[model samples]
Target: MFNIYKEMWDRRKMIHALSLQEIKKEYAGTVLGSVWGLVNPLMRIAVYWFVFSIGTRADNPVGGAPYAAWLAIGMVAWFLLNDAFRLSQKAFRSKRSIIKNTPFPIAILPAVQITFSFYTHLILLVVILIAMAFALQTVSVYWLQILYYDFAALMLLLGLGSVTAPLVAISKDFGRFLDTVLIFLFWMTPILWPVENAGPLENVVKLNPFHYIVQGYRDSIFYHSGFWEHPLYTLYFWALVLVLFILGNYLYKRMKPIFLDIM
Candidate 1:
């Protein structure tokens, strides 16, 4: 695992270049271009706000926080985590040519894709922060906890991507399977609803590592609480992350060599 990370560091320049190119290509030929990265999330938030707040009148204060504020925080975390996994499915397929022709670390493919999505997430994070400030009247120091949560999200992304990218490379059906899995997870997660409102099912939702992240974001902006406030959740999240990291590294080490032949 250390050696794989060392190789990624040794080829850091390649990762940066590829990540930047991917970001540019994502918005290429569009009128808004990179601005869409910011716009898309805002649009989604607006639509959801309208549907739940105005259309259905389901917008209610969650844990004493404004519905919009809670929704934005959850959506910001969800968008980043979702994009990390979704784009990771393409890590090998999208860069098969570079993998076949280049000699750099193939592990960097998922890193590049995740980093590209992180850029978009950063934009949305700023938008969320600004909106929170207006809605809450103040942004507390706890908001900085978002950095910790974002790091957790990155580790989870890299770890899961390490496993899934190789599996998807080997079998296209695996990618579809992952998509279905993510869809189920999305609904199960408390992005659009309150975990407290989940009642008896709250324990089931708590089993999801993503709930830690989503709730952590809300804690940072809306709840004004630090991650350490919930020691049990922190422990559970890190344990899951560590397991995924080990499993992903093992899979990548064994499967990376076969990627070319499969491609």
Candidate 2:
């Protein structure tokens, strides 16, 4: 396992290069190009804000922050997570030409996808910070704690991607199945709804690994709460993420040699 990670680290430059190429190719020929990274998240926040805060009359502010600010915090993270989830599954298929032609490490493919998502996440984070500063009247040091959740999220995505990307390449139906499940996950994960108002379902929703990430974002940006404050959640999240990493690595290794056979 250590050797596997060591190999990936040694290819960091290649990963970075592929990630950038992926981003450029994705937005190639578009007028705004990468600027859409900033625009896409803002558009998503606008629609959700209008629907929930205006249409449904769900105007309760989270942690004293305006509904828009609170929603932005979670939406930025969700957008990143959602992008990683969907793209990672297509990592192998999307890179079919490159995979067949290049001798690069296969593991870096998912890393490239996740890095691309992280780049967009960084832009969205900046937009959200500006919104929070305007709406909340104050920003706290605790906001930096988002790095913890971001790291956790990256690990989870890479782990799951390692497993699913290979499987999706083997059978396209798996991709379709994953797409259906993500729609359910989107609603269940509390991005559009406030956990405080989930009533008896609050505990159940908290069980979702993503809930910790979404809640962590709110805690860092709005609640001013440190991660250490929630000892059990921190422990639980790391444990779950660690298990996923192990499972993902194991499955990825088993599938790696067979991937080209199917592709």
Each candidate's root-mean-square deviation in Å? 1.4, 1.5
lDDT of 2 by residue, 63-144 (tens): 5777777788888888888899899888888888878998857777877898889887888888778878877778789988
Tens-digit per-residue lDDT, 128-217, candidate 1: 788678877896888888899999999888878877898999998989989999999988899888887789988888999888889998
Q: Each prediction's TM-score against the native? A: 0.95, 0.95
Task: Report the number of the highest-lDDT candidate.
Answer: 1
Q: Which number leads on TM-score?
A: 1
Q: Extract clashing residue pairs from model 2.
A: none
